[model samples]
Target: MPSNDSLARASGNVKWWKNANIFQIWPASYKDSNGDGIGDIQGIISTLDYIKALGVNTIWISPMYDSPQIDMGYDISDYESVYPPYGTLDDMDQLIKGCHDRGMKLLLDLVINHTSDQHKWFQESRSSKTNPKRDWYIWRPAKYDADGNRQPPNNWMSCFSECAWTWDEHTQEYYLHLFCVEQPDLNWTNEECRREIYRSAMEFWLEKGVDGFRVDTVNMYSKPMDFPDAPIVDPLSKYQPAGTLYCNGPEMHKYLREMAAILARYDAMTVGELPLTPNTKDVLDYVSLKDPQLSMVFQFDLVDIGRGPVDMMKLTGYKLSALKAIINKWQTFIEGNDGWTTVFSENHDQGRSVSRFASDAPEHATNSAKLLAMLNTTLTGTMFIYQGQEIGMTNVPKDWPIEEYLDVGSINYMKLIKEKLEATGASEEEKAKAVHEALLNINAVGRDNARTPVQWDSSPHAGFTTGKPWMRVNDNYKKINAAAQINDPDSVLSFWKRMIGLRTKHSSLFTFGSFHLLEPENEQTFSYVKKSAEGDEKALVVLNFTDQAQEFKLPTEDGANWSLLQGTQPVEDPTSAPLKAYEGRVFVNFGARD
Candidate 1:
């Protein structure tokens, strides 16, 4: 179904990753082959064919390492082994082979920013001040008052716990943990520690035929040499949280260069989760081909658009046009520098895109999901589709009991907010109302929304497991499951297939084209033009971000001789037509007909 011209243009793409889209999977929720109630590597191996059929040539699997599950699998206890619930090292080897057999690359989550307290390195480091591994993690002597009451070495706070410094009575010192107290921060300043961390963990995977890594907290590896006190930004905050001083630290680039050199030893690709990447300059410096520090980096500014701190109830009132402007800046910046960026709407750590950014109305959810797919794919980057995204997955039920939620961050946030409200001396009735509002907001933005088991079919447990599922499946699975949509030509699943086909047939147009936003003032519509770098081909992509009928008029200079290339709604005319709610289309420009 691909046009010959589009295929011809696509064949010009140079980098394999530039032309290939990626599929992201959260293993615990993907599928369970064994009766263990947890999705494992074997479950992923079983779905490799389905993923390949989706037209994606890469898979970014979230962490499956040995862990305490305190932070899911991010709190790694053994970098060289798999979590018992997930599978064994042999299962991982089979997964690598499965991906390779399908001509797809596999990227494991590399979470080296911290390790669980159960890790051997941390255990030995905490054993004694004279231990050889004592300096493997950040440890400092505790400060004491004249009365002999000990205080934390610094004012820094943990991202999950209220306090960052956890005391180790045996050593009589405190260790730093940017996240949970169980996951202590590694001392990247230690040369021996860095070598062991990389050689033992990373090299082990690469030698086993693993492709690369989706480096977690990639920019937070370095900390400022001087552990200075953070300026108090919130008077009522329980503890001072200072990530700005350490995130993207002075030595981060140097570390990245070293890491990149090591990665270059294998045939692989690296995309980093740069949580603190500030601007265009940082992006260019990290991913520019001239320096070649990384394949790409994930920028999170768009995901936090409307949410307040820690998924609070406060809303930012962000508009669609504002999102267009922000994306345009990054796209233009990357395209100009010969660097690359990634395009995605939802991942393991965030809520579903359809429910948060687009309409989740029963009447319009499918179309909105399709619109988001069109917007993300037509942009100039390698696209990543999360599981269930191809089938229009909705958020969990808003009234889900707090006890059913499993994300530690969300649980901690709930407790933090409830405590804050009670501290205000408000009446119980007022406090209850405030707490209810916060819970609703959490239901909207919580990570649990994306962590629910994949809705494979309408069978019990949504066909994810014959045994009990780790989490509850969405009640709408009966109507929205993959079994119901895969056969329907008009379903979200079919639309995603069509989108990926267009991407492959016109890879050059997406990989090297210059992106320009059209009608940046349009509040309800997102429209853009992508012209091939050599000016031989050009296309227009228009998407209705809202669930309401709308019309769009291209600039007169664009000319009216356009032909429809792909569309979510039936095309009546190429240049002018009434678009249904959440409708979108990609059109190719023909020279002006005099």
Candidate 2:
């Protein structure tokens, strides 16, 4: 457990993730408890000890709520109910109780941006415009283009693909679904909707002693009221509409403050999955403790490796200066501010960290992965570690076709490919390659990479389940698995154990210390120093984002030699002694130049 003093020391200011390291568990693939071939609360309960052993103080589970499962539970039919397939409410209760018993905290997914179309609330809203619940969703009267053709109310594009509007014959209007048609966006403008969603949903779990919430699609709550047609970016963009009109609306801060007030009653940790580019500071300002909209916001810009928007060709490219600038801004923003930040390289939505950020080559992959872990763990912010990250998982197989693609973003991109091909009169092969590359950009590094069943052993299912899993497990399980790495001191899993243990051990140095970026100009190699009032600490975070090892000079304090803190490929060889490919080193600054 982390020391109380360290937590308190780090608390007066908002940046909680700084002293904390959280492990994310994607339930469906973690471990199945009931021979039901799916993971449940019982499965999570079984792994509590294992998670505790890893030294992580918190666990953030993906959604396991009642849902159509159309979008893997993102389309929640019941915000307060647990999915029967995953487990009963009792199971969640027991798990929460058990987590508390083991001194671990639990964070549930907060998917309030939209609700499943099948939800009772949606059913009521869609029944008739005159119904009491009709105002619960964002439904608008249909408008006609110059051609007099019936069209959606606005040019709102779904994050999954094109337009966010879904035509409903009964209502004679389109309901908004920022992601999927099945997941209709709720109407925050409705007072009842806002109160019910926040108070009821929050109180449900807070009553059960859940400690925090991980908000989903947080920035999509507010939309433009104009409901006007959007200018065409792509004739197909007619589908998504002008998202800017609805995204980060002027009243978003107002709604957030309302929700924050309720969350504060229970002192629940609030983390928003804020997707923003220019509004980084503005977003933080809304959620900082001073305003209390939330406790923290996740930082994904570092992991959003695509050069612009979602381009695959630049996925492997490194912009050290850009990456440094991003982190530096975040560090400065939350340093003395009222809010905090959560650190991560990969998650259920991202490709495996080693595969996406690090080279897949065995010699360098795991090292690169570890270097990523070191950078976050030492930086002045909280950290989130995804499942299988500890063991260095890679992206999924590329053989999966459109039929196998389950993620909406991937499928939508597939549609876009076909459209582009037809519009440009390209060959079938060209179209397929374009779609595949786009898929590679979105889900290729591996949509299912993090979704692969947990590798617990060399046996079948890697000890994840006794029966077939909903998703396929990685083929490399035979060689790279929990059983094989648990005892290996040099294994990635062991290194993570070290990373977590150190944070808990040196909370004073790791959590409450001041953070400063060493270089803001260099783009490839990231270096920073974490300073404290009593003493200064430095860590040279050198990473080879490229495929090969490159020689470079890094500043080191005289007598403050660098040591391999946690990394893959050993940095012991003479030529690579100073730096290892995909490796990260933490050096203690002893003062004076080398």
Of the candidates shown, which would achieve the greatest TM-score relative to the real structure?
1
Give the alpha carbon lDDT tens digit for every residue of 1-594 in model 2: 333332444544534444557889888888898776788889889989988988888899999999889888899999788889899888998999999899888999999988899999999999998999998898887889899998777665676666678889987888888888899889888888888997667778888898888888777777776666666665534454455566678688888888777776776777788775356577667656567787777766776754445322225665667777777767666544455666678888877777665566666766766777776677656778888888877776566555655666666666766776888888888877777666666554435567778888888877888887777777778877878988888887888888777666655555555566765775455667665423544344555555545665645434456544445455554224545456565655433131
Residue 478 lDDT in candidate 2: 80
lDDT of 2 at 371: 72
Residue-pair clashes per prediction, in order, are 0, 18
lDDT of 1 by residue, 35-71 (tens): 6789999999998988888888999899999999998
Residue 537 error, candidate 1, Å: 1.5
- lDDT winner among the candidates? 1
Name the regions of candidate 2 deviating beyond 4 angstroms. 1-18, 310-316, 442-446, 519-524, 536-538, 544-547, 550-576, 590-594
Instruction: Give me candidate 1's TM-score against the actual structure.
Output: 0.95
